[model samples]
Target chain A: MNFNATLIGQMIAFVVFVWFCMKYVWPPMMKALDERKKTIADGLAAAERGQREHELAEERARESLVEAKQQAQEIISRAEKRAAEIVEEAKADARTEGERMIAAARNELDQELNRVKEELRGQVVSIAVAGAEKVLEREVNEQTHNELLTKLAAQI
Target chain B: MASDTLTSGEYIKHHLTNLTFGQHPDGSWGFAHTGEEAAQMGFWAIHVDSMFWSVLLGFILFYIFRKAAKNAHAGVPGGLQNFCEWIVDFINDTVRGSFSGRNPLIAPLAFTIFGWIFLMNFMDLIAVDLLPWLAQLFGQHVLGVDPHHVYFKVVPTTDPNITFGLALGVFILMLYYSIKMKGVGGFFGELAFQPFPKWMFPINLILEGVALIAKPVSLALRLFGNMYAGETIFILIALMYSAGIVMAGFGGLLQLGWAIFHILIITLQAFIFMTLTVVYLDMAHQEHH
Candidate 1:
């Protein structure tokens, strides 16, 4: 083939094709690819961030669970200590009441004994007066008799 | 020269020649009288068939790719969009691998060159007689012209003119980029210097100039040689049918074998052309230090 006007025509066609491709073909495709890459990167980053946040929330929940468990334990221990103190106070009150009642009963018994003894002494003095009267067979002075009886009672 | 009177040599020569339009030896403007006449007509003639087929294939490439580009989206791609994107990606990868320069034109240029030349060379796979036979029929019935004079060569890349034309454009771009990247003085300095001392400047100029010129020459010749040889083989296969039934059977087998192997040649030639172009441009863009 001769080197002729076909050379010029082919060159023109090449130039046109290259121009069209550069202007219309390459940029949009490259831009679309870049945008897709960016989108994928951003999506991965967001996923990672969400995972991190989920982990933090789980950690917080675990910490609160531990804190609640400690608080419940403290409450139970405090309640047990208060119950022991109340039982000790009730025991002390029962012992004091029993002692007081015993003392009162003892005092009542002593008073009763003293009364019996006094009554017995009074009856004995009366019997003695009666026997002396029968033997003497005469009336005696009342004031002198009373003084002797009281003195006898004191000796008894 | 009638079809029945033509010998095997004449038939093959006729099939190989382009439909040239230029100044006749009698100082007239018309179709060349013969293949020899066309060859002797020199630089002023145009190979009409090469130009027509080349431009037609180029338009086809542009229309399809442009449509794909127009409908392109960032979402899932359909068949046409997928094909277009595949081609773009292939060319982009080639350019990215070979070309280190920052110019945006290299990828598209490589794409255009590869696609256009591939389409042109693909015409070789068609039966050698098919288009010319069709043109003969059209010329005889529709145009009221002699059918025997209707010449058409389908494979444009088989023509050296078209291949050289493409290489010439790349060469010009190479020069432009070299000058732009290296400045005027540095461009000449590279051409005349290096791989040699400054004391041997004239020798360096000769050596580098020959090397520089050889780039485009080799690029053009490599493509043209492969395609032209392939086309000639197909023509020779077509020529075999006239010998005898046994010869025709052998030709058929040979045709199938060659066609299968030529497929690789066609694709490889296109790939080589594109790669060398990118490499040359890359060299031009390099700082000559």
Candidate 2:
């Protein structure tokens, strides 16, 4: 228990141990701790970045979906409008053909009626000539008779 | 003194004395034959047991920590690594809490002080008779020496020399950091200046110098007093147990209870010693305007 040379010996031991611990023990352990801290921080940062990128990707996907739907609607509407225009043109073509056919039929009917009237006039003129011949029982002047017949034909 | 001849008081006295080796009063160099002889040998004598046990524990601490350091990794730690890291983290926290400066030595110093002193103090937990009895047996059988002449004091921290030695080391570091942080002029000025005032320089010097010197003294005495008292109690219990079978049973129970309580004392003493060292060094590093 006396204060003695053990003090010096223990002091030397303490100093040497401190030096050993400083050189060997402390730095690596602290470095490991710091490394673990930095790694955790970096991992957290990376996770956050991944989450943000995922959200951006989702947003882009949604935007493209909306744009695609709009394009599809435009294509459908354009097709519908073209079909309507085609139907209108087909109707106008059918109407013009029907009017031309009706006009030709009417002209043919008028020509047929004029032809029938002329045939009826020819029959009547023949019958009247026969009767006159039977009544007179003699020949008449030919040039004057022919002239009267032509005039009769023009009237009919 | 032979075991059969010793009174309870003499027994306790025997347990309390160190195995001192130094110059004898007859002006020869040798081991002190008795406690009175050790004390009479004066300042130059070394406590062989204290030096041996303390150095052995210090080396053991160094070896274990060095092994742990060699195998240390940044990955998940296993058992030895985990324990080592926990100790490192604990010391680091203590230093960070107390020390504001960036010196690298403080953390490791705290670690060594805590671990080495704890091991030294832990020596007291061994049955008081166990080690000395073994040494006596070895001395008698192996060395062809008288068992009565063989003395072994296992608890190093119980010795004033060792405790004071540790405190002295801290004191040196304190002075070193004081000069390093504040410069030589500032350190001397601090020692000579206002706890009173600059005009009362002489008075301040006396007051502050006493306070400065008191730091290591208190550090040493606190650990020494606690450990020595605990060791004395254990020795008393051992003496009681040696009295008779009935007294032995009662003493055994008391010994168990005291040993359990002493664990806390030993650990706390180690903690206090380490903490004060850190605080003292931190105080030294502080730049007082």
Best by DockQ: 2
What docking tier does model 2 reach? medium
TM per candidate:
0.75, 0.76
Native contacts retained by candidate 2? 0.82
Error of 2 at B191 (Å): 2.2
Encode model 1's per-residue lDDT on B62-88: one tens digit a residue: 889888888877777789988988888
Best by lDDT: 2
Once fitted onto the true fold, the runs of candidate 1 whose alpha carbons sit more than 4 angstroms away are A43-156, B1-4
Worst 10 residues of 2 chain A by lDDT: A135-144
Q: Write the per-residue lDDT of candidate 1 for residues A1-156, one digit (tens) a residue.
A: 677888998898889889988998778777665666688889899999999999999999999999999999999899899889888888888888888898888888888887877887787777667767777886555577899888887677
Summarize candidate 2's per-residue lDDT along B1-289 as a digit string, tens digits: 2267788877887788888899999999988778889889998999899999998999998888888888777777889888988898998999999988889888999999999999999999999999998988897899878766677899999998899999999999899889998999999999898777789999999989999999999999999999999998999888876677899899999999999999999999999999999899989999986
- What is the overall TM-score of model 2 with all chains considered together? 0.76
The DockQ values of the predictions, listed in order, are 0.48, 0.52
